[model samples]
Target: MMKKKLWSLGIFIILLSIIVYWFYFSKPTSFPTNEQLVAEMNRVFPEATASIIQDTIPIDERHVLAPFISKGDDYGLSYWVWKNHKWKVASIDTKGKPMLWKLNKSDPSSFYFVWNIDPKDQISSIHFYLIRDRGYQITRGIQHYNPKVQMGKRVSLQEKSYGLMQLSGTWVTFMNAYNKVESAKQYPERNMFFGWIPYDQKDMGIFPENSVNGASYSNGEIGLEYLMIVDKGQIEIPR
Candidate 1:
């Protein structure tokens, strides 16, 4: 009886060890280095100007991860999940916003990244990818958002929420371009390009128009004949 009990305990320990190794030890890491990312961008898109938009560069994972939904749950709204090259990554894209990364709860890693995106009217698609690795597991994912230019009715400019930083000259430059479009009957010649904006005003980046007769219309509307030119490059914009 004693021998049988010892044998049973030994088998249980072996099974537990196997489970631990499979879940934690045998995994890949998919995180990309700053250099690797830059090289990838250059390889993929060599034609357009690919400067590192320092402000929009998501190098840290702090703001990328969502805050706790409660005490027990840790995972946020994750969209892409994968493992590659010994790295683990998880990402979520809310359309216009940056692709958020998921970090480890126990050990937080510092990430250094560079942005090499160009703004163009011909672009039909935009994609952002995030990667992370922990617990000997690697994961990665990409989120793609398409930008389509269409006509809409012009409307009056209405007062909406704006970030204090947006008032500090970042968006001021674009205001001039907006005036130029508003004054002219022709379509706005210049288009705005950027990767990130002040988190506060990131959602309300669209241009509003008000006619001389007190009627208002949003840009691209049928009744409205106007165009918006974003002047900032580092700020990400909503379509």
Candidate 2:
């Protein structure tokens, strides 16, 4: 009986050691390079060649966000993760745009994200050309995207909700090319985007018809539009 007990303990120790080694001591292969990544992406998209906007955005040592544009110019987002001791393509958002990444959820009461999205326009890019100020002022500016220079501001209406439903949630804002007060380096007046007035509900009506209005709009979570939301966690967007 004593010998048998010792043998059983030895087997258990061996299994535990293997697990520890596999998880920590044994690392997976190196991260894929741009060329290797493009090849990997070709598996799903036959005509895939290069990334869409930029190269892969690293979330951490184990996770990466890759956006690709097909030879035909169609765009897509692919999420890769290190799993089972190998790099695996966990999932892909074929029609995802970077708008969701720009969405802000800092203040829920003052801002609410609209749960309505035009699925047909999923991969569409946002261009703000018309600035609708709170005073019903409107201005159009020519925005030149130099690719090298990062400029512009993004606003959102929501407290960073952890649920995945926010992925499809899009707060309505005027699509403008450039902000009028670029010198100030602040977001255009409250009228530039449509979000809730934050306070004095009755004042919402005082705004002119030409200005953009904002506030979160939803008929509860029961509809085709409220399918996926954004997660606040890094490399972990709940859907």
TM-score of 2: 0.37
Model 1 misplaced regions, further than 4 Å: 29-89, 94-96, 99-102, 105-118, 121-239
Candidate 2 residue lDDT tens string, 105-193: 33222221222112232211121111232222234764433222111223331331111122212222212223334425555333332
Question: Per-prediction RMSD in angstroms?
Answer: 22.4, 18.5
- The local lDDT score (0 to 100) that residue 220 gets in candidate 1 is 21
- lDDT by residue (tens digit), candidate 1, 52-117: 212222223222221111112111111112222222223211111222122232121211111111
- Scored by lDDT, model 2 comes in at 0.38
Going through the candidates in order, what is the number of backbone clashes in each?
39, 22
Error of 1 at 152 (Å): 36
lDDT of 2 at 124: 19
**lDDT, model 1:** 0.27
